[model samples]
Target: MNKTLVAGALALTLAGCASQQPAPPFTLTLAHINDTHSHFDPSDARLTLDHKAVFTRLGGHPRLLSHVNELRRQAEEAEQPLLFVHGGDAWQGTGYFTLNQGAMNADVLSRMQLDAMALGNHEFDIDNQRLAAFIQGVNFPVLAANLDASHDPDLKGLENLKPYVLYAFDGHEKERVDSVKDAGKRPVVAVMGLVLEDMPDMAAHTGNLRFEREVDSAQRTVRALREQGVKQIVAVTHLGLERDQRLAREVNGIDVIVGGHSHSLLGQFSNLGWADGAPYARQFTNPDGRGITCVVQAGQFAQAMGQVSVTFTPDGRVSRCEGGNTLLSDNVFYRDIRRGEQHRLNEQQTQRLKAEIASQPNIAMVAEDPALRAHIDKQYLPALNRAYGEVIGHLPQALKHVRLPVDGSGSQIAPLVAASQLYWANTPEVLAVTGRRADFALVAAGSVRNSLEPGALKEGHVGLELLPFANPISLVSLTGRQVAGLLLETINASLPADAHTGKFPYAAGLRYTFNETSKGRGYLDRIEFLSQGHWQRIEPDTRYQVVLNSYHASGNDGWSTFFDSQQAFTDRLDLAFTNGKLTAFPVARLSKVNGGGVQVHYINQPLNCQDQAVRCNTDARAFIDYVRERRPMLTALPESGVTLKRL
Candidate 1:
């Protein structure tokens, strides 16, 4: 062996070792938004800034895009690895969605250049075909690791709807590293997506697609990625904040979770008069107890954006995660100079508030993305404006819709919705279909999307924005025991501190006291039925005719009891009268079909209506009629429908 040969071989071996060495510590800046819900324009926001109540416009898509683009620019300047993603649910809220469907969503979101998005349950609000079309239109991947779409023809083999995507980021360039072979030993970050397994309970138009349990799918994906030598892992989930925390606790290798569905705004915003939430980029101990998993989410309706920066060790352990949520606003601000009127801030107050806003870490006054704003204005706004322009009626005072009972009262708007359903049931046309008038009406808090603002109300406000689902009115006969079971089951489902409060029940001719800390058989402290201008404890044996939306009748969102009891009446449902007699009548049953379609059937023969039989009563029509009957003004019911007491 010569000296020259030995030196050359040694140098070659050293070079090989250097090439195989572990990558350096990496920092990833994650920008995320969630539950935007088709709010293209700014919504009204009220904030208490510096002990002064003020009115201002808060986030819209145009402003959100501006902030995200700025962050992208900053990340590019720093040469840092960055990912921008949507948590889920960018559909079905305002008049834009009602008029344009998912076309507008696909167009707008594609332009934003998202890396990946979690599949939200509301995405299934339309049929499988439309959902497939929306997914096809988007430039980024629509992800759901738990979804099994093999059985559905529309979503069976989508190129972009994958379980996970891998990215390899070098100092100067970031490339989509889809395969382990493609990655070739470079440091890789895998972003996996997980959605709710209980899809049927939350969404009505899922088709043949089935969802796996979120934790199970996440664990499997993380393990697979680890086996493939992908160290850094991010899970984009639509499982809500608490579920994201649970996923962080249970999943071993995930470093961060960008979440939505519960629409949690993760940050301290109490100073801005917004509800305070868990701190942003909060870390949870992984299953191994040594690794850290950070969770973050933005507020609903494009109101806020969350930015998190995480530093990871070579072994994929998060050393630190820190970030905050910023509420995007415009410079135009207002103050309540008079009791009920909002006045534009003068130069002095405006300048002072501007200074204060600058000092706040989470409030960012940003401008709208000019191009996107122009696109919305030119392409979509005119149609929406004309469609929603007609005045329906007026609200003398604002009716608030709180999901959970607060300060001893439940939603002021949901009860109104329920009352409308009951009122429609008593109308001559509806009475011809069911032989009897409804004893009470039930509605879920989620059914009413927003509170009713005082002033001249428009068709767009009620029909499109407030009750956008447009669920058909349904009639069901329930015994007192069955009704009690329905209420108890739904109440218990919404009882968890982290549960989706949208399932909380509100009623028209019913009222109950709920003990939040109850350990008894059920949470109901007491239940009563309003009858003949009097209140009485409902009898267990008495059968009552109930009016509810078809969505609830099909047993969605913790209303399984309704389905189990009403399944027998798919044909002709028997109605019970106060005279202790049952009359068999042909009942109208509405069933959800493919592609956001509804299937209607009459048990025997169709009811005789003066006009269209099936079109005699609809959810929106009922509300419209009630509003017309009330005339010049609409107000909340005189009684508090729910009394919630906590220990």
Candidate 2:
């Protein structure tokens, strides 16, 4: 053979081998928000600055959309693949959801151009039929691989509700690169949604849909995607941060997890008096021990946006992950002073704080998107304005709401809320119906969505924003033992301190001590009852008249003890705003136990509005009336209501 011919053949062989080599690592960017909970307007957020509390506003859909759109523009200019998603809980946080239901959510969210969304547990806050309607109304597909909606007539075979959504990025035109077939031989990215397997416990109206375990569902989905030649996998999950980490560790082939449900602020913010959760985009070692999965979650209530840029190798392992949660806020800042007046921050101080915020990776001062803001103003702000205008009371001091009690102190406002319920129960009309005044009232920590800042308290703050759920006040009788057991069951359900913290209990007219080392009685060491202005040990055999929100009264949110004890009792009564009057009636009962032992019930009984009786309202109404009439200043309790002891 000629020498030149042999050399040319060798060069061609080397060129063919190079073509077969795996592709270089590619970059993809994601802009995400979770647990937005219908915050279409800026919300009050407090941060410590210069040893003083600075009141400012954070997020809202408009601001969040601005941040996301800018990021998308930047990514498009850079010719990088990008996606925007919502982790979950897009409904039921503010007055908008209270008034407009899912219509407003679908309309506003559809405008944001989301690639996909996780079917958050709150989406089931209504029912399967309503959820199906919302899904149909939204432009983006709602993904939920673990959900088997076959039993639900409305959800089964729903066109927009999918197990997974696929995307493929070509060299340019990021917006047009959704189909895998369009990009021949290019890597496809699969995004799947995973909700809580025990979703019915958190959301009562999930209907007949069944939730499979998160880990098993994720693994199965990833395996299927891998077999189909999809390399990059993202799980947009409603599982809290802890569960996301667990899924990352237990499962294989997951590249990233965009998580919600815990409302975790997954970045450094402790210096501002905020919880510095685990760093955003932190990689967890996969089950294979070599592959890496990055997890990211923005804080709740439309307060933050999570922007993550990931570098993925050919085999779908996360090579490098960056980005953190950015808290979008307005330029305004204030401090409370004498006579409950808000002192606006000076220009110099505002500039200094803004400079500091700019230096931080997790906070951004962004202006609201004008078009979205205008749309909200035209379509939604009228009802919210009316709701916010009604001043219910005033708070002289700020009260923080921490779900898990720390240093033997629980939520300041939760106790106040419970006291309000107790006040309603003791009202003459309510007492007459119950045949006696109530002993105490208990409310879940989750029921109180926000802390009470020192300011003019509005009716919307309680009814539309804080306790926005339509839960009524219900009265029940329980022995001291059952009361103790109820507390234990709820506290244990919120255990591990990282997940399900919402179920932690807070009370008024009662107090308890928790011992960490004591396994006996599920860490509840002591129980006390307030009697004649003195604390006394509760008598286990004594039947006490207790007032609780209807949600807990029905055993939702892991309050199984409430359901177990009350399910068989015919004495349960719910206080409702019937015909504009507060009236008591028999608690609604389900025909039978459903999946997860949840006894679904509804207030379907017909009532005569013509009957002569004093009308009253429940839930937020009770709290509003209590604040306006009983304690406008909202002072702390006489003594700490909780004590914690460690081994």
Over 389-464, each residue of candidate 1 has an lDDT whose tens digit, in order, gives: 6687887767888787756767888888988888878888667756777888899888888887768888678788
- For candidate 2, lDDT tens digit of each residue in 1-647? 99999999999999999999987788888889999989899888788766678888899999988998899889878878888999989988878997888899999999999999998878887777888889999999899999998888898988888889888776425433445556577657788999899887778687788889999989999888887777899999999988999999999989999999998888888878886787879899998889899999988889889889999876677889999888898888887532223478778988888888877767889999999999999988887778675777777777778887766667778888888888888888777767778888888888887776777888888887778876778887888998988888877666563576888888888889877764322577789878888989988999888888877877788877777776555467777766565566775553334546366354555333224542323778788888898887777777557675544
- Please provide TM-scores, in order, for all candidate models, with all chains considered together: 0.90, 0.91
Give the number of colliding residue pairs in candidate 2: 4
Measured with C-alpha atoms, the lDDT of residue 557 in candidate 2 is 84
RMSD value for candidate 1: 5.2
